[model samples]
Each structure stands twice: as structure tokens, then as C-alpha cells.
Target: MMRPHRGLDPGSVWAQRLRQLEQRLRTKEERIVVLETENALLHLKLAEYQGLAGRSTNEVLQLYAAHGQQMKLQRSSAVTQLHGAIKRLKQDLKSLRSFALELSKDFQRQSKTCLYQVLAAVQGIQLQNEAMQMFQIKAFDLEQCLQEVTERYEKEKQKRKALHNNLIELRGNIRVHCRIRPLLPFDDSAGHSVSQDRRRNFSEKVAYAADDETVLVKCSRPGHASVNKTFQFERVYNDLESQDAVFADVAPLLTSLLDGYNVCIMAYGQTGSGKTYTMLGPQFDGNLAFSIEEESELGIIPRATQEVFRLISEKPPGSYWVEVSVVEVYNNEIFDLLAKDSYGKVFGIKRDVVTTREGKSDVPLLTHETVENASEFLHLVNKGLQLRVTHPTLVHAHSSRSHLVVTLTITTVVFGDNFGTSWEDEQTSQRLNKEASCTFPQKMRDSKSTSSSRASSPVQLEATEKMKQVKTRLQLVDLAGSECVGMSGVTGAALRETSFINRSLSALADVLGAIAEQRSHVPYRNSKLTHLLQDSVGGDAKLLVMLCISPGQKYLTESLQSLGFGTRARQVQRGQVKKKTFPVPSKGK
Candidate 1:
């Protein structure tokens, strides 16, 4: 079509077509460059994204593997714990069921047993109630019978006491009791070697207790036949006798002391023969420190003191007053053992014995301790004993160098039925008026005469009612141990003491010998020992001499001398000791 029109139009159309092709080609080339640059940037970004994605993928895979292993371990542990919990629950359930079954069984058994016990207890209680009623009835009847018997027994006891007292009075008041001490270890060992040959030839047993009241001594001479001598006494205690047995025999004497009678108990013997032991018990062994509960071990002094207080307690209060004095005759001088200075220091003060108008001996300036009970009395006694002069010797370990005398003075006042009037009332008033008149004659003469006349009048008869007072003394004498110089082996001061002791003892023996022989004069002034004991020896006081002896053959001479002394003492008969009773004037009569 263009070929027909063809000429210049064809050429223009062709040129236009060529320009358009070039423009299109250029536009395509610019798009291709932009696309290529974008493609290169996208390739770099994809490479960075691939690298980051590769690292994240590796981290995620590792996390998943570790999480899977952790989950597996947790599941295994949970399974194991669950299995153990189930096993424990099963065991606990079985134990609970068994315990419940056993508890039911125990409850059933206990209920049945309780029912039976309750029934038995009810029956037993009922039986006991009936038995108690019967016992009450029997007890009433027994009490009535006992009341009647006690009345009769009391009447019989009074009669018996009267007869017993009469019997004791009939027995010689000056009674001698002999006691033989047991052979000690020292006694056995003393002359063992020297007497070995003598032991073979001569019998060690020289003295024998013939009976309860007699001692038989046989002389052991090598060339001569044995001469057996028997001595009788009021009571004789063998070596085997205990302190209680000896005290029992002397118990009645204490009763006489409470009956208002003056009593003297003295122990005399050779050294180491138990003279002190008989009166005050053994020394150097704490015998003096014994308690009151140890009654069986108490000696005469303690027992007598306790008994006196017991008897006083039986009486009404304010009826009796007891006073005690402890003194020792050392080196022929009387010393108050309980005497002390204001500073509580014991002083060796000398004492003098004076004879009262009533014929009783009184030591002037003596310490008179007022005691209420046995303990206080014993305390005073211990104070004196501690101050007692004692020294050791070859024969006796604890030898008393003095004579100890413990005196208990009891003043008892008995009230009469008539009150506000006493025998002493008129007498005391008369004496007072008389004394006043003598002092001031002009003023008191008329008053004294009127008072005397009134006192003698019948209106004053009721006022003259008698008030009896009983004053008694109990003397416990612990004589110093008599020793031979050769046997004692003493020297210096001890030897001098021994000589004084022997002389005093000899003087005592002389006095007793004179009394036994019924001499005109008893020679009580021969020594202080005899002079101090004048009333107890020859007066109305009852005297009991305890002659202690050693049973060993080595002490044959001393034992014989002691037996002879006891024999003489027994023969010295004293008058029946009457209880001291006198009318005491009431105060402000």
C-alpha cells in the first residue's frame, strides 16, 4: 500500500520508525541497568539473611535437644517418687487396720474384767463394815475390864512400895558394893615375861566370884598351900557384868535420894581398877561425852542425875529446886572446879568446908549452878571434868590426881491445905520484931511485945498452919585412884601427888576402921577427905561404898587390900537414914 503512494511518505515514515526504535531501545537499556543494580543489592541482602538464619537454626536445634533430655530425666524421677509414695500409703493402711482390730479386742477383755472386780470389791467392803462393828463392841468391853484391873493394881503397887522401902531401911544404911574390873591388855602384857615362870607355877586366876554377893580370894604362894578367903558384901559385880546390870542394883538408892534422904555413893580402889569408871565412866575414850540416849553406857553420876530430874518432873511445877556444886580435893586443898572469873577464865580458887548449924557440910564460895534438866546438869559436870587434873602413868593412862565430889542439893516445898497461912509466918514475924527491937529498943519494944502476943493468940492459930519442906543432898564422890609408887612408876610432881593420895586414902581408911570398931572418936579430922565426908560416913546419911578391884594376879596385893577395906566398910553400921523434913515459914508471914 505504501508503494503505491510511496515516494516521500515512505521515506518519512521509515525515519520516524527508526527514531522510535532508538528511543524504545534506550528506555529498555535504562530499565535493564536499574534492574541489574536492584538484583545485586538483593543478592547481598539474601547472603546476610542466610547467614543469620543458619546461626538461629543451629541454636534452636541445640535448645530442642537439651530440652528433650531434661524432660526425659524429670519424667523418670517423678515416676520413681510416685511409686515409693504408693508403697508407703499401702503399708500405713495395713497397720491402721490391724491396730483397730487389736484395740477392739482389748476393750472387750478389759470391760469384762472390770465388771468382775467391781462385784468382788463391793462384797469385800460390806464384810469389812460388819467386822468393824463387832470389833467396836469387843473394844468397849475390853476397856471396861482394863479400868477395873488398873484400879486394883494401883492399890497393890502402893502396898508393895511401902514394904520395899521398909526392907531397904532395915538393911544396913552404910552398904558396900564390890566390883571387879576385867583384865585389860596392859594388865596382861605388863608382867608377861617376868611372870612366865610364875605363870607355870602359880595360877593366874587368884580371885573368884563365889556368889553374887561374895568374893573368894586365894593366896598363890609357891611354898605354902593356898589360903582361900571369902568376903561378903551388899552386892558384888563380876568382871563380866555390864554397866546396866550394876546400875539396876543401885536404882533403889536413887529412889531414896528423891525421898528426901541424904545419900553418898563413893568409889575407892587402886589405880586402873575402874574407880573412876564406876562413878564417872571410862576416860580417854569419850565416855564423858555420851548423849542421854546412850543410857546403857551411863555411869552412876549421869544415871543418878537423870533419875533425880525425872522424879522432880513427876511432881507439880514450882514445888522443887535443884542446885549442883562440883569440887575437887587436890593436894589436900579444896578447889572449886566450876569457879570462873568475870572474863570466863577458870581460876584455881581455894574453897573451905564449913559445918552448918543443921550438921550439913557446906563449901563456902562454891559455884552452885541451878539446873532445870539433866542436860544442863551434865553440862556443868562436863565443865568441871574438863578442868580436873589428870595425868598419864605407867599403870593408869588417865589417872585423876584429885578427889571429885559432885553434890546435888534439892529443896522441896510442899503446900498445905490452908492457904495464906504458914508456920513460918508467926515465927518469922516474931523474929523480925525481935531483931527490930534489938536494933532500936525505944521504938520497937512495944510493937514487938504486941506482935509476939498476937502471934501467940488463938486468932493467929489458923495463920500458924504448917508448911513442910524437904531438903536432901545426893553426894557422888569419885576418889582419886590409889596407887603404889613402885607400881605407878611416877616421878617429880606426880610422885608427890601419889604420896598425898596415899596419905588421904589411908586417913579415910583409918576413919572407916575406927567407925567399924565402934571407937569413941572416929578421927574424921585426920585428913580433908574424911573431914569433908563426916556426915556421909557417920551421920544419918546413907553411904554406899563401891570398892573396885582388879581381877588380875599381878594386882593381888592391891586387890587384897581393897577387899579388906571393903570388909571393914561393910561392918561399919550406920543408923537408919530418915528423910529430912522440916516446917519452912512462908514468905512475908
Candidate 2:
């Protein structure tokens, strides 16, 4: 620390300091010159700034004064414009308030109108609902009235049917309806072969249907005088009459059959007449059975069969059953056409006629096929017809050699109390009463003490109301046409057949004649045909005989004979046709 002054002296330090001062003085002077120069430049810059400030101050003052005056003017104008805008806004607000009030009144008026319309609609709906209710009540009343009217109509229809049945019954049960067949080609040829002068003079019209009930046949004998014979019958059909017209007259008989009456419809005529055609229409080539599609050509039997099933279908189900049996009387012997042998072949079988205690004839061991409808019934009938003995004759191409009889047995079972009390019940009651009234001796009573004790007990009575069975038979007979031996041109067996046919026809005529005379001993046993038709000819059975005659001069004799038979048959009257009702005895009776 003390050695710090050793290097330089104080004096030298002072001298150096003075020298540094002189140099500093000189540098100061030079710096002062520089400062002076800088000052001058500064002064020059300040003077220019002063000049620019003076000019900008003057411009700013002038701009400030002008802006002040403009602001004053704009303030005055803004005050006026604001006052007008406030006045327009107030007017717009007043008009909006008035419009809102008017809109509210209009809304209230519209709301009132909608309310009135809703009320009117509600009232109209209520009126419509009331009217609908009234209409428903009237509709119900009308429906009830219509039902009553329908019931009345049904009752009247039933009454009319009953009266019609009675009227049919009033007419003779054995009725003869005569039918005149049209002239065939053979008849025309035979007539043309005769002298033309005689043909024109002899009147081709040998037979004429005078009226509904009379037929006039003029006998044209070669040697004998011409005798005009008038025959009366229940109904007479001319050649122009259709099968429908013919069946219309016979339809009532079928109704009676459904009513439980035994009915028999027979066709009798000479060869080449229309017996087969009347009972069975023109033979179909391959179709042997009746068809519903062939309604126009349907014969009496087929129509009757359809009608029977139709009437039965109208009744309650399971209340009735129909059975059919077909048989032929050939060579004075009864043969079942539907009979089956042990080989299952339909062969000729002999059948014997048996009489019941009720005076009904039955062919025992005959095949009775139960049928349901018309088709099935006609099928069986056709099968039997196929089995019938038919041969070609000079007079007729397909002539039936045997008499065919189709029997329809209808058994109706009625249940419940509507059948009434049975006769067997009455008989049983009578027997019970008699047993109760019977008196026995004391010793005998002692011997029969057990029996007496059993009798003393309460006897169990049988059911009084029983099922009733009404059995009705509708017999449709197609008798072999009677043939003249000379005209038939037959020999050997054919001759024998003709003889049998004539004999049987004669026997039938005799029976009818006997009935007409009211003979006590009617020879019904003379022939099988008459015996089989005993009920139809004499008993209380409805019968219709269609006596077919050819309206040709060649068959004048046969036509007259057929007309005579019809007249005789129409005269033989039987009692009223009563329905055959029998009480089916209960089991173990």
C-alpha cells in the first residue's frame, strides 16, 4: 500500500495533469467549434419546424371554427327531424292499436258464427240419429209383418194342397186315362197300300178325341157297317199331346203315393201302339237308364220316380226310406228281373205270389233294393229293363215280350207323438184290463200263489206312443202289347207267347168286366196278372190305366178294343184311397 507512489513523482504527476489540461483545453475549443456548428444546424431545423408549426396551427384553427358552425347547423336540423320521426311513430302506434281492436271484434264475430254453425250441425246430427232410430223401428215392424204374411201364405198353400188331394180322391180311385198315339210309318204304309179312292172316302181319321173325357172311334170294317163308338174316360190325350201333358194328368197319383196310398199305373195297348214309349221314352242307343238332362223325353215312370224323391226330400231327414223291386210276368210265370243266382248272375227266378192278412200281395224272396235318389232308382229300373225279354216283331222293332212291373215300396217312419197312439197299445191295454177283471177260484189261486203275487205287483206299462210306419207301393206296369197272330207273323214259341198274352189280357178284361158289374165273386185268381193287380182293380187303391191306341185306319180294330177296355176300366169305381199306415210293433212286444 505505501509503495504505490514510488513509480511517478508528485511533481511529474502535477506536470502531466497540467499538460493534460492544456490538451483538454485545446480539445475543448475544438469541440466547442463543433458544438457551435451543431447549434447552427439545430437552429436551422428548429426554425423550419417553427415555420411548419405556425402554418399548421393557423389551418387547424380555421378548420375548427368551420366545423363548429357546421355542427351547430346539423344539431338544429337533427332536432326537427327527430321531432317529426317521433310524431310519425306515435301516429303509427295509434293506427296499430285501432287495427288490433277491430281485429279483436272481427275475431269475436267469427268465433260466434263458428259456435252457431257447430250448434246447428249438432242439432242436425241429433235429428238424423232420431230419424235413423225411427226407421229401424219401422223396419223391424215391416219384417215382422212380412213374416206373418209368409206364414199365412204357407197355410193357404197347405189348404189348397189338401183340397186338391180331396178332389183327386173324389174321382174314382181306379181311373182310366186314354192316350191316342201318332200314326207310325208302318201304319201310313199299310194305309197307303189300300185303295186311294177308299182311303179318301173312308176317312183317315178313324179315331178322334171328342172332348177331354170322351173318345169317338169309328169302326171301319171291310164288310160290316161303320159304327161310331163313343167311350168315356177320366182323361183322354190325343196324338198331338206331349208326354208332359200326359204325365201332368198322372202326377196327382204320384202325390197320392207319397200320401201313403198304394198306386198302380199301367200301360195297355195293341202291338205297335205307344205303350213302351209312353212308359219309357224312345230307347237310348247306349244309355239304358233315365237321365235328368233328358227331361223332355222323360216318360211317366221316370218322371214319377223323380217326383217321388223330390216330395220325399221335402220331408224331414231319416223319416222315410224307399226300396224298389222289378219283376216280369212271362209265359204265365212270375220271374224277378233283378234276381241274382249263386254265381252272381241275373238269371230267371220263379216267384210265387203270397197274400197277407191285410189283403196285400207280396212276392217273397224278391230282391228289394233300397234306393236313395232318382238316379239310383232309375239305374235299377234300367238294369231290370235290360234283363226283360224283348224281341223284334214285324209290327214293332223292339217289342216287349213280357209284362214288366216296377214296384217302389216307400216306408215312412214317423217319430214322436205326432204318430198318435198305436193299435197294439190299445190291444195291450184291453188285455191288461181283461186280466185285471178275471176272477179265479180259491184252490186255483192257492196253486198259482206265485203267479198271483207277481200279478198283484204293479205291472210295467209299455210305451203308448210308438213309431208309425206308413208303407206305400207304387206299381208301374208295362204290359206286353196285345198282338194279332196274323199281323205279328210269329210261329212256334212266339205263337205260344202270343196265345199266353191274349189269354192273360182276356183274363184281365174279364176281371175288369166283373168289377164293372159289381160281381160278388170276382175271378181275380183266374190269371197271375189279375191276381197281382187285385188291389188296384178292386180294392181301395188308386189306379191309372193308360190305354194307348194308334190313330191309324190299319189299327182301327185294336184301337176300338183298347177304347172299350178303357171305358170299362173307368166305370169300375173303388172306395176312397186311404193311406196305408201301420204301427210298427215295438221290439219284444
Model 1: per-residue Cα lDDT over 1-589, one tens digit each: 1121434443344445445645655665565566556556655665665565565456545654777766556655654664565556456555655655565565556545544554555555567568988999999899988998998888886687557546646654467889987777767545324566654333266777787788988776767987988998877898898888888877777777766678899999988889887876654232335665565666889878888888877755445667777888998888887777889766557887777787665566677666777887887788788888988887778889999999887755433432224423445434434433333223322221121112212112133244335567899999998877877789999999999899999998898888777788888777787878888988878888999988777778888998988888877766576656554443344
Candidate 1 runs further than 4 Å off: 1-168, 171-173, 191-203, 283-294, 416-468, 583-589
Worst 10-residue lDDT window for candidate 2 reads 448-457
Candidate 1 scores a C-alpha RMSD against the true structure in Å of 33.4
lDDT of 2 by residue, 1-589 (tens): 0111456543444445445545655654565466556556655665665575566555555655777766556555654664565566556556655655665566566556545655555565578679989999999999999999999998996797567556656755467788887666666444325676655543376888887678888775668898888887767888889889999888877887866678999999998789888998777322435355566777888888889999977765445567778889888888887777787776668887767787766667777766778887787788788888877766787878888898887765543344433422444334433433332223322321121112211112243233345567899999998978876777888888888888888899999898778788888778788877787777767888999988777667778788878878867756566666655443344
Q: lDDT for every model?
A: 0.70, 0.71
For model 2 the TM-score comes to 0.61
Q: What's model 2's lDDT at 524?
A: 77
TM for every model, in the order presented, reads: 0.61, 0.61
Off by over 4 Å in 2: 1-173, 189-203, 222-225, 284-293, 420-465, 584-589
For all candidates, what are the clash counts?
1, 0
lDDT of 2 at 131: 95
